[model samples]
Target: MTQKEPAGSVAAVAGDKSSLLTMDFREKSWIKVQKKDGSVIAEYIGKPGEQRQLEINEPVTIIVGFAPGVTMAFRGNPVDLAPNTVNSVARISLK
Candidate 1:
C-alpha cells in the first residue's frame, strides 16, 4: 500500500518598493498574510503551480501551508525555504 504523503515544503520571494511580491506553488494550499499588529492583510487559497502577486507597504508576516512541489519568488528573485517543510511562516519588511 502506498501511504499518502502530506503537503510539501513552502518557499517565499519578496518584492521591493517598485515591484510586486509573487509566490508560486505546485499544490493546493492556503495562504495568509498579516501585519505586525496581527491584522490580516490577505488570505486566500492557491492552486497547483499557481502564482500570486501582492503589494505590501509595511512589515508583514506570511504563512503558507506545505504542499508538494511548492516554490516562491519575490520580484523575480527566488526565496529559499526549508526542504520538506511543514506549515511555514516568513516575515517580510518593506522599508
Candidate 2:
C-alpha cells in the first residue's frame, strides 16, 4: 500500500490476495511491477526515499530503472539485487 502519488508517480494493481513485494527507493528512479499475464500492478517514476509494499498473491516481474539506490524485500526477506542487474537496471522475477 502507498500513501501518496505525486505527479509522475505510479503504483497500481489489477488484483491480489497472498504474495508480496516491497520496495524502498533511496534515490529517484523508475519502477514497474507486472503480473505474469503482462497486466501492470504498479508503474511510476519514484521520488527519492519513497517506499511501497505490494500484496502480489502470485509471482510477478519487477523492473527497476536505477538499481544503484533501490532495495527490495520479498515475503519479508531482503532480496539480493545482484545477479539480475545490468546497466543499472534490474529485471527481477519474484514469487
Give the total clashing residue pairs for model 2.
2
Q: Model 1: per-residue lDDT, tens digit, 8-27?
A: 61222244433456778677
Supply the TM-score for candidate 2.
0.75
Q: What tens digits encode model 2's per-residue C-alpha lDDT throughout 1-95?
A: 84564676333444432245777889988888999999998897777889887776557888899988888887567888878999999999875
Model 1 has an lDDT value of 0.62
Q: Which candidate is the best by lDDT?
A: 2
Q: TM-score of predicted model 1? A: 0.63
Q: Tell me the spans in candidate 1 whose CA falls farther than 4 Å from its real position.
A: 1-17, 67-69, 83-95
TM-score of each: 0.63, 0.75
Each model's C-alpha lDDT? 0.62, 0.78
Number of the top-ranking candidate, with TM-score as the measure:
2
